[model samples]
Target: MLTYYMPPKTMWSNLSKETLRIYLDQAQQAYNDLLIGNKPISVSYSQETGAKSVTYTQANLQQLQGYILELQRTLGINRRRAMRIRFR
Candidate 1:
């Protein structure tokens, strides 16, 4: 008999659910840019503006990996439907 082991929740507690959501959002943006064949998108910040803004294709790979993991959390039915809808 084989025993499967799952890691403790504390290992992931450092990253809140909201953080995953934010990373997923960024991944979607990067994918959209990739679809449009855009490269090296610009990211800018301003002290007076109190915010940063830009449009480009550069994305954090670690964040994207996390987003992929998030997508993997979904079931097969929903994942299949999403893939079909997204491509068409």
Candidate 2:
């Protein structure tokens, strides 16, 4: 059953289903963190060049958030379940 959601044209669009799922989870987590006014998201990378090892960090808060929103919009994830509460 095909729903109305389609993947957009992005760098991560071609990822495997499992990889995409992992990224989606991470993106949602980062979005929630940002909403709660927490620290910026960071991704670390280490490179080796024969006799040299360099380590650096990439601050990816905005990018991750943008991708998350884009994914949500393109994938029709904007729907929220209705909730009802009653106290007597």
Best by lDDT: 2
Model 1 residue pairs with clashes: 41-56, 41-57
Q: What are the per-residue Cα lDDT tens digits for candidate 2 across 13-85?
A: 5545565555567667666776677766542222232232222113655566667676665454674546989
State TM-scores per candidate.
0.37, 0.45
Instruction: Report the number of the highest-TM-score candidate.
Output: 2
Give the count of colliding residue pairs in each prediction. Answer: 2, 0
RMSD of each: 11.6, 9.8
- Which tens-of-lDDT digit does each residue in 1-88 have in candidate 1? 9754433343233455565455446656765666577775444333333755655444554544454455434211123322444554
The all-Cα superposition gives candidate 1 an RMSD in Å to the true structure of 11.6
Q: Candidate 1, which ten residues in sequence have the lowest lDDT sum?
A: 74-83
12, model 2: CA deviation in Å? 2.2
Which residue pairs come into collision in candidate 2?
none
